[model samples]
Target chain A: MEQILANGLYLGAQYALIALGLTLIFSLMNVLNFAHGQMYVFGGFVTYTVVAQLGLPFIVGLIASAVVLAVMGALIEKFLFRPVIRKSKRDESTMLLAAGIAFFLDAVILLLFGEKQRGVPKVVNGVFNWDMRLIMPYDRILIAALAVALIVGFILFMQYSRTGRAMRALAQDRVAAQLMGVDVDRYSMIGFALGAMLAGLVGGLLVTITGINLGMGGPTSVKAFLMIMIGGAGVISGAIAGGFILGMMESVGLTLLAAYGDVTYLVIFVTLMIFLAIRPQGLMGKPWG
Target chain B: MTDQTQTTPIVKGSAMSMNRVLGVGAFLLGVFVLVPVIINLTGRWDFYYTLTSVALLSVAAAGVWLTFYIGRINIGQGAYALTGGYVSAVLMTQYGVSFWLTLPLAGIFCALVSVLIGLPILRLRGVYFAMVTLVLTEVARLTALALPITNGAKGITSIPLPGELSILGLTIIPDFATLENPKLAFYLMAALLMVLTYLVLWRIVNSRLGHLCRSLQQNEELSASIGVNTAMLRVLSYAISSFFGGLAGAIFVAISQSIYPSSFVVQDSVNFMLYCFLGGLGYVFGPMLGTLLLYFGWDLLSVAKEYQLLIYSGALIALMLVLPNGILSLLDKKGGNK
Candidate 1:
């Protein structure tokens, strides 16, 4: 039980970061950025290339990943999403554009990073073992700590910073924010960049422990979607809660249903579908928000 | 929402005008008669496989398009397709049922399954519905992997070809095994199904049900206030949409003689939506044209080798930017106003 708790906490920290980025994008643009996972994978590859290939420091690699992804996110918003959203009558049309960008990023990732699974060398070299009941690597602990720190920082930024406040206002009501003199286009880009940076930060942090691969992009996006759905779409606090809940469920499910093999995910997915059916608004989100 | 001014004009006019009949007849003649003759002259038998695939894919895309008609961004059509394939495969391989019998059975099963799934999620807002449907393909894949009857990861394989159809000892259709060229046989079967699927789709879009569905698309609340059964309409369209997906999948399995969990993945589902968007969501035949263009475009890009996907995606993005209303929108006199 202690081990499960520890594992869940670790997973929750990382999962929350991913969900945060996705929910952030959804709230800001009202576009479910399908390429968010590809961005995460791209971040992982950036970190891998920096720390492992170029022999850069782990901190440098992480920062580089965030910076690169922020730029990419900003450019995509300005060029692809912004114009498409402005011109297209159907709001759902962005989904096609998002899917296209996902494919583009995926192809780019494959060509640049290749299909091999890659991991950076561990920054710390110790295993934290407690009474033979719980075991985790020190790198995992460090990554989890960093993830938590980033989440807190993000929350604080959203609460206190000018740009963050403008973004929050934009998410709350786009027209109202515009009427309030918020530069909708500029802030939308910034929010997208910040969201993508969160994905990158989480990806870079977790690469040392879990490794990264080309195929992980789609599954990662789906997992993030599950987390957000569990909590509530576009609800920041809901994303955090959903992440921890999903992490706990996964940890417990995987451990208990080990003998059953792959049934854990199937059960989780079906449960999510049922849960959405029961409460379309989710745990924290307003109905149709 | 402000951009909703550019409404897709409710398809109006004589249902069967002389010009429309002639145009459709000529198109059918080209598909059924000219294409096979051209393939024979060119001696490119592989074109049959490619065209058959396009036909099958467009059938599934038609279902996706129907959901779009009702204002839902469906990304789960692949789940129905996969389920349909498995249903047909399992019945044919394990129960010793004829493939001919499994086709409609597969579609009916998917329609039933979709009603159950759509009942709840269809009430959610568009994006919520879209997100929920997005996970469904993966869920279907996992279910396929976990279920014992599906043969797990190995999948059901080497299923026999579709047998003859007969009534009262009078043969209506000969067995596929007895055909001289199964490729040609599959192509014709797929084309026939495609034609039938579109006919039904056209009929639905022109019918009163389709009009009510369009109202749901425009404003569900207003429609509901005006005495439309919004929930029933949504679920009904979704069921019909999924039925088409199932039909496509059943035929696909028959052609391949196999069914695998990985046969229809999330990418294929996304591509189904892409086909709708590419062709023009406003038109009934949009998905068909979109599937043909995208499929042939991808085949043409095979020479690009490693850069094929990059080019394809780039082109897709550029095209979406240029023609947000889709390729058919280009034909509109006012350009997207229709």
Candidate 2:
């Protein structure tokens, strides 16, 4: 029972962290960024190279992965999305572009890394005992703690920082924000970079739990896409809430159902999506004023 | 100015183009039938199977392209294909139903399922609908895995070849077992089916129904205000789309002689959408061209081995960047693309 809680919280935290990136890009730019998962996988590759191959400290690898992917995200926004965005409908073309980028990155990774899974040894090994009743791994605790820290930090940054506020303003109203001199284009880049960075952070963290591979991007994108939809996309808080809820459910599923866990998780995920899609207001989302 | 306005009109093509389009469509489809036969004459039978698979795949992609015409992004067409494959497999293997008969039955089954689900799910607009569809193929895969009738993870294997197809007393297509290169028979069947399906699709798109669907793409609110029954139109297009997907999958199962959960996966769903997009969603026949190019393109890229995907995806991105409207757009008349 205690193990379930620990694992569940850890999973939820990771889901929240990864989903934060997806939701950020969607809300700010209205670009689905299907390649967001590729960015996450890329971050994992970078961290694996730094820590596993280069024998660097885990902290150094993590920071380096975040910075590198953040820049790549910005570049993608400027080059990939900007050119044809106005030519076609934003929803359709962005999806196609993102899928193209995703396939490209996946192939590149497949060429570079092959299909084998490579693990990054845990940063902090050994277990932590609390009152001799509850034992947990230190790295899992650290991961959970880091996820919370980052989510809070991101929220505060969005609330207080000038650029963050501009992002929020854009989400709230595009034309109004543009009228007030928030360079829509610049803010979009920041949003993509920030979103991609958060996904990279989770990717780096994921190396400790699961080995990274070339094909992780497609499934990761699907799961994250489902998470946002269940939480009623178009809002950050909803993404976080959906993440934790799904995280707990996934932990329970894996613990109880084992091999059939994925089916159960998706079944529950789809049910909630259908329900919320019908409602659209969702549990925590605004009533669509 | 008056001639231009009268010629183009506002909504669909002029009535006079119908016979011309029919003539061109018949000619192109005739080429599909002859091209493989011509290629096979050189002792290269593999191209026959490859092009056959292309036709089958484009049939499904055409369904997705239709949904796109109605301004809906459908990412789950694979679900219907998977379902349709299973439906054919079950009927033929379990009930002793003829394989040819299973084609329309599977299509009708899938079409009904789409309408049953489309009523509520179609209410959601844009990405929400797309995101939900993203789960659909996965859900179908899981159900196939868990369902006893689907025979679990092993999937239904060794599905018998379709019996000889006949009309009245005439045997048009011989049984699959009797053919020396069954791939040849499959190619002919797929090519003929592709031609017939394209005719139906062309008529639908060029007809009043096609105009209504295009109106939804341009402005749903305006179309609805004009009493177009936009919701009903969406549901209708969705049904037609899934029907084609089902027919294609049914044909696919007959060719492969087996059905597995993994056979039609989420990735295939993505590929289906890409085929339509890469073909030129604006044109009714874009999916056909797109599927052909993408199929052969991937085969050509196999030379690169490990670097194939990298080069292929890079090319895909470059193509989209250069021709957002797709390769067919290059041939479009500059000022009047339509």
Candidate 3:
């Protein structure tokens, strides 16, 4: 039971970061980036390379991953995404373009890193004993804490920062934002970069546990999308609620169901279908204007 | 969405008359019919498998194109294909059903299943539908793995080829077991199926229902407001798409001689969509052209060994950016739009 709780929260936190990034972009630009998970993997590998291979400090690696990935994300937005957007074919090729980019990233990673996963050393090695029975790794607790902190920091930024206000305005009304003299192009780049940066931060932090699996992109992307959907797309609080809910559900399902663990995805898939059928706008996502 | 504004002239049959189209189709049919013979004569019979696979894949892609026509992207056709493969396999192996009978039965079964699944999900537009379908193949694979009837992950194996075409042991058509190059027969069979699949699509596109479908693509709200049953149309298109997908899967099982949980993965589902896009989603024959080029393109890239996937990805991204309408759009300036 304790293991389930810990794992669930840990998974939820990781998913929270990824889902937040996805929702961030969706709210700002309405682009459902299919390649976000690939960037996550790429970011994790960047941290692994910087810290484990180059013998750099973990903090330095995290910062470096964030910066490098933010740059890559911006470049991708400018070249791949912006062109498709400029053509006014946003919905058509967004999925395919992101998927193509994801595939490209997968191939690049496969060629450069090979198929084997490279494990990263724990960020901190300690144990937290609780209630004389439940015990958890301090590394896990740290990872989870860092995830929470980043998320809280992000919420505050969105609440207080000028860019955050601009993004929220854009999300609410694009034409209005443009009329208000907000630079949609520049903010889109920032939104995308910020989204990628969050994915990178989570990827870098979770390297202690996830290590680095090249094939993680597909499943990761799906789960993140699921979180956003469940939380209601276009809402920050919705993303958080959805991510934690999914995390707990997955944990409880794995623990209680045991032999029926795989059924969890089937359940998720069916639930999403039902939810979309009955509530197309989602709980928090107002129909896009 | 880009194609939504542009006219679908080719599929509407605005440019080519029936005679020219049929004449071109007949010439292509003759070429497919002769491919196996040429391979046999030269003794390079292995290409028949590649040809057959491409043909079957085109059938699946055509199904995806139908959904694309209705303004919905289907990334879960693999589920129907995989289900179709299993249905035919089970019917043939356990129930002693005729291989010929299972093919259309599989299509019907998949159509029914798709209708059941689509009725609810079709209400959601755009990426939501695509997202739901994207996970469907995975869900299907998992279901196949968990179900006792599917025989777990080991999967059903040794599926017999379509029973011999014979009368009182006097063979009019040779069985796969006895043929020197059974792939030739498979190629011809697949080609015939492809021809029939497109013929049905052709008939549909020329019909009133096809015009309604095109209208939905161009403007869903306008059509819906005009009393067009957009929801029912979307479901119908999806059902037909899955029917084709299932048919292709059934044929694939006959050729592979087995069905597994991993028989058709999510990647194959994505590839089906890509084929439609790469072919010119606007054209009915686009997937046929796209599938041929991509199937061969993959083989040609095998020489690169490890870098094959990298090059493939590059090609896909570049292809989308440079020729978003698909390579077939390059055939004419007025937008292949078929």
Candidate 4:
């Protein structure tokens, strides 16, 4: 149980950061942003290029990934997302459109990076001894701290900052927010950029622990999807809670089910299905109707 | 969605007839027939599996079409195909069921298994549904790998091809009187695809069921208010899709004569989606076109396996960006809008 708890928290940190981005986009855009996973992959690639290829400092790579993805998010908003929003294409169509972009982006990355699994060098390597019997990676400890800090910081911004309030306003009622002079497009761009940056941050943290690879995005995207479903979309707390729940479920699943390493994914999806059937609004989601 | 705009009636009675359908079907049948003959005639038996691969891959593509027509994407088709292939291979090799008997049984098993997966998964909406399907396929893969029955990672092989059948001690194997050889398995596959396509789609698309499904696609709220049980219809769509997906897998096993879990990976599912997307979604004929072109292109690209993924991804990106709808959408530009 201790091992499961330890593993779950470490895994959960990654989930929370990625899910935060997914939920933010869902709340404001009404789309799942399927390419968010690809964005995560892009984050890994950026970090790898800076730290590994360019021989830059680890901090420089981490910061550069967030900044670069922020720009990519803006571009996505301006080009890919703008048309979907403007047309008010059915929400389903928008999701498909985003998926198409993700598919294309993943392909491009595969072409550019190849499919080999490459691990980013661990920035900090130490084991924190809790009990005399158990130890955990210091990298994991850092990830957990960063995730919590980011979540708190995001909540504070949403509650207090003028731009954050504008984002909230746009999410709640786009037309009314527009009437109140909250530039909807600008707010959406802000939401998207923030989402990308957070996803990039997770990607950076992930590579430091696991590795960088093009195929990572596909499963990671599904995990984010499951997290949003469980926690309910558009709510920051929901994203965090959902992410941890998913991570815990996966970790427990791995320990209990010896033969299936990918059991985490299957269990998460099945859980999502049950949750959606019982409460489509999610654990914390408000009913759109 | 763009194709939804191209509903202008063209040659309504003449072009859409069962007779025309048969004619087009026969022409397609003839092409499959001619290919192998040309191969045999040219004395290139080494290339036979290539043609077989195309025909078999079409079955998976057709499976994609079933859900796609209803405006849902089932990324798990490869899982279903793998399920059928594995089941058929196992039943044949271990239990010694004749290859022919095992084939249909595989299809039946896949349909039943899909129901189990679909029951929980069908609840997800749109992108969520796609996500869940993706997850389920991966689950299917991992489960297959973990199972002792599958021999774990090693996989099962040497599935014996059933010998010629006899009814009451009389040979059921008719002599190859002319062009219809026993290798006419390709023709059998083509025929099954056409029949399944017609029965599952042409019939549904022309019926009240089609109206309900399309209505759900167009406006879920309005459809529900108007007495459509949207959830039930969606489940029905998935079930039907699974049926064909299983059938495709069965046919694939029959043609290939062996099965492995790796044959139906997540990447293959994505490729199947690429086939459907490239051909055009929501059209009965779309997957057919997409399968033929994409696989044909894949075969051509095999020489450069290292660069194939790059080119494949690049092409997919280019296609989706240039034609969000699909290649068939270009049919409109050709003034065949009718």
Best candidate per TM-score, number? 1
Stretches off by above 4 angstroms in model 4 are A1-3, A81-117, A131-134, A173-182, A256-276, A286-289, B1-30, B37-51, B162-199, B224-232, B302-307, B332-338
Q: Which regions of candidate 3 fall more than 4 Å away from where they truly are?
A: A1-3, A88-90, B1-19, B26-30, B41-43, B166-173, B332-338
TM-score-sorted candidate list, best first: 1, 2, 3, 4
lDDT tens string, model 3, B224-283?
999999988998999999999999999999999999999998889988987887888777
Point out the worst 10-residue segment of candidate 2 chain A by lDDT: A280-289
> Over 4 Å off in model 1, which ranges?
B1-16, B334-338
Against the true structure, what is each candidate's TM-score?
0.97, 0.94, 0.93, 0.85
Put down candidate 4 lDDT per residue, B133-204, tens digits, no spaces.
Answer: 766677777677767898867777665545555689897643323334545555555555655664567667
True contacts kept of each: 0.80, 0.57, 0.49, 0.24
> TM-score for the first chain of model 4?
0.93
lDDT of 2 by residue, A1-289 (tens): 7877777788889898888899899888777878878889989998898999999999998999899889999998888887867665335877778898998888877776678888888888899998877788888898899989999999999999999999999988889999999999999899999999998988898888787987789889988887787676768898898788778887777777776534666567667656765686455555541
DockQ of 4: 0.30
Query: What's the lDDT for candidate 4?
Result: 0.73
- Please name the candidate that would achieve the greatest lDDT relative to the true structure: 1
Kindly report which residue pairs in candidate 3 clash with one another.
B11-B338, B282-B338, B283-B338, B284-B338
- Local distance difference test, candidate 3: 0.84
Write one digit per residue (lDDT tens) for candidate 4, span A5-114.
88898778779889999888878877777788899998888888888888888889889989998988888887777765564323444544576678667866777677
For residues A1-289, what per-residue lDDT tens digits would candidate 3 score against the true structure? 8778887888898898999999888887767777888889888998989999998889998998899889988998888887876653336766667778888999998987788887688878889988857778888889899899999999999889999988888888889999999999998899899999998888898787769889888888888878887777778988888788889988887767677646776676677778777887566776641
Worst 10 residues of 4 chain A by lDDT: A87-96
